[model samples]
Target: MGEEMPLSRIAAAVGTPVYVYSQAALVERAAAYVQAAQQTAARCLVCFAVKANGNPALLRLLGEQGLGADLTSGGELFLAQFAGIPPHRLLFSGVGKTSAEIQQALQAGIRALHVESWAEMERIAGIAQTLQMAAPVAVRLNPDVAADTHPAIHTGGRQHKFGVNAQAARQMLLAAADHPWLSPVGLAAHIGSQIRELAPFRQATAALLRLAADLEAVGCRLQYLDVGGGLGLDSISQAAPRPAEWVAAVGEPVAQAGYELVLEPGRSLVGDAGILLTRVEYVKEEGGKWFVVVDAGMNDFLRPALYGGEHPIWPVALRSGRQRESRADHTWRVEVVGPVCESGDTLARDYELPPVAAGDLLAVMQAGAYGYAMSSNYNGRLRPPEVLISGAAYQIIRQRQTMTHLLG
Candidate 1:
């Protein structure tokens, strides 16, 4: 807490239930990726996935570091422009892209579009062909690799909503060679997010490489192998490799294959650098269980409710620990919940919180990536502000959502 900004100051400026991201931390982290990729034989374009945390400040810092942009939406492309990332240094990826969105990417002159499905590849080709423009695209492959991640995040699985199957991709790549408007340039694979193990990445890369090899045999020129973002942060880095370590492990094949490697890193870059602060409002007991309520609800962070995700919750400011005479260790098992009226609104379940009282501060750690981006106006609670802190100084990047903003 001391190395970063003091939670006290951020709360004072933005009020509680706000998210604060450290710009310095984000910049330093981006530099690390650049350095690590340079160490390898691979010529890398480190593209920050704008789907993660698209705060203009974070994006601009990444651009200053010479990182590229990976966008999924038109707004994301616009954000990259605002962050000073030239369209040429950007790559766009998504499963469902409307015609307007594809046209926007084309006008932006993005580096490449990672086409996920056969239909998408055809759609992009048709759009580019009509405009008499040459489009460079990579075929996103569902390699059927079982990543060592939560089932819900496993995109390579047959049931997942992302990427074209290997068979379909092979057919698409060869067929794309005939399209004058679209250039078939590369292959892309993303197994899942928060993947901690090495074997799954090795498996995914090996499959993607093999698929690329087969396509090359058919006279397809493969210039880029995107290897889309899924690198994770260490909430438990004890088991998880740090950023550089993971990059080296996951990226070795790109060096061997002698292609330009594009990395779309989302959570690993921004997750640990931000925290969410909420103010405790009340405490109660029900069904022989202790409950501590806070102002930040599922509306503010849906990870817990949506994915049963693990977010380490802790006290922002330490208070003296005392023993309660009733319990053996004087600790009570507790469920930390939010103020949302829905019974499903829970931040965490069946854990321990400090003896919480009204006005106490709770900090949800490692929240920078999906926290604000996924927040909603459920229960009519205003979305929290976002802050960036440097030493003792702090600035608000996003103001708290106001009630009137919803009305409008």
Candidate 2:
């Protein structure tokens, strides 16, 4: 935990509203997935989703731990490479990749490109032909399996603009057989994110396996099946599926189908591994309601405002020897907000906290995933720095944006 390193020390050194990640946590989280896959009947390739937190340091750490990189765009491909993730360990995914992005992936010779639609497949094939290369392809199947998570994060249902239908995927593969530049080597499916239950994953896997069986029947056997990641983490409870449990629940079926398994875990591995540290700038009362405004705004961490997600906020630098008692005594209800000039810039609403005052630091927990990755420079607020803490030592992984950065 960053607190063990005295987050205040890092804040003092690097300033407030910074992301603090534990190297121990990141390595342990990644090892959990590897250990789980080893226990499974099939070989598993764990691709760390780049869209979650593309910090080069984080990506490099995971890569050193034997995790591959799952990229969404050409920029991510470059990040993966810069992080020293081998070309063979890289997987390109997403629905809106441009023609140039596809060309870059092919030129780089990534392990595979998880094709989202038939049109994208056509584009990749055309680019591969132009480059005189055989593009490794995986058609992402939209199983129509609905996850009961937030609607915005859902990707598998037919209505979503993600993967193609099972029939369409099969047709695409058949068509790809005629294209010399395209190699249909795998099938992929991502149902949704922050999924608390396993039924949806099971249903999606069943659909993929059935399609795999049909493909085999048509002499189009898939070498791998990418069970796209959506394993959820409970921000409040600090609860999530154990790696072994997750692998058994989702990887068992794919293993039984005789296809190598690929998982693109973004949140489950890192969601609870980091926290956003912010200093309470002011505490005010207006309209008989308490507002605790912090230095960090939506520009630093946007999940709370964007997805209506809530992260447990804790006061840093607790009173010595009375932390628990102090927490128990201070039960004032307050609204956690940022200085961003927008009504929707609230972090947590109707939250109970201790007697937090100006200059007191607050750590937003379970923000390792979408927190900083989705942050923006809206309202001219500069983004925060990111610090990686290991035991009693810490280092600034990303520097806080400067005022001149906005001009650029």
Candidate 3:
């Protein structure tokens, strides 16, 4: 919606199945989060979760806006730095960290490594000892709080293989405080992603504060509380929490406790800032059902198939001769599908839209976050290009994978 060029023009210029991201949306969303944190907390770091979308151009743009990075792997760390995000602004976090990745983060002198287990802490300690460097650490505590989101993305509960329990976290932090190579700099917890309500965050923050109090009693003071992010995007029926509301939910208590706040917002920041431009390849009818098939597949955009994600699709331009159709038309009931081999590649089932035919252009909304980040070379399909739009101008940040490149 923020783009100056028409969707048809973009489709024609870049070909179908290209990702188009709005620079204005990215800036606006980032500013909102930073402003909220500044207003609520005395000290805060609003880190963009790099796992959501790691395009170099997008990362560079975000870095220029004064946002830090929440990295989950060595590649992400490298990309963040490559984008001009300084080491002090990068925080590495993940459940499983290779010895090499730990060493890499330590050598890079990142802000902190959010440790998820005692074994990981020991590993970090070993790596730091070898490097003769003090590794900044944050224990990711599993608050056992349930979030109302897709189970595939859930991470905070005890059943999930995410963070350690509060007891284990306390023990790890205390041990880190005593260790020579590890510096216990922060306490952290991430319940899950795409969380829509504030109640679960409130519960998790309360638990973090209680744990911080116990640690402080023993002279173990933390510099910040890393509340991992999962703020959800707006749904058809329910509205997600705004960045300010989410910041307040977790920031207020941490600020009152005299600790800095760290948030790893992933989907919420970039989710609504992008769209997937695709072209309709065919319209077929089978078993008394209509199907609108597009060129994009699960290998290109996996959210709909992997997580049952329901991204709204709209025609880029209505037929020149046809009038605007009403929703009551039964002929519009159709299943929007992709060319992937699996049946799960269906993007939307029983979706209502105006009559669409082959050669029509469609835009899939709200795909900025996990769309391209999770794509693969499955079935040997080439990944699509990525375009960044800023007002009237647009640039192709990532070129489409060529067959020569893929084979080479």
Candidate maximizing TM-score: 3
Lowest summed lDDT across 10 adjacent residues in model 1 is found at: 322-331
Candidate 1: stretches off by over 4 Å = 1-4, 235-238, 318-331
**Local distance difference test, each candidate:** 0.82, 0.87, 0.90
As a whole number from 0 to 100, the lDDT of residue 97 in candidate 1 is 85
TM-score on alpha carbons, each prediction: 0.94, 0.96, 0.97
TM-score of 2: 0.96
lDDT of 1: 0.82
Q: Which has the better TM-score: candidate 1, or candidate 2?
A: 2
| RMSD per model, one decimal | 2.1, 2.5, 1.8
Q: Which candidate number would show the highest lDDT if scored against the true structure?
A: 3
Q: Write model 2 residue lDDT over 1-408, tens digit each, in one string.
A: 643698888888999889999999999999988878767855779999999999999999999999998899899999999999999889998889999998888888899999987788888888888888999999999999878777889988889898898899999988777678888889989898888788898898889899999989989988888888998887564466665677788799899878898889999999889999999898888998889999989888888787788789988875444343323665788899999998778989989997777888999998899878988899988888888988888888999899999997
Q: Regarding lDDT, does 1 or 3 come out ahead? A: 3
Error of 2 at 265 (Å): 0.4
Pairs in steric clash, model 2: none
How many backbone clashes can be found in candidate 2?
0
Better model by lDDT: candidate 2 vs candidate 3: 3
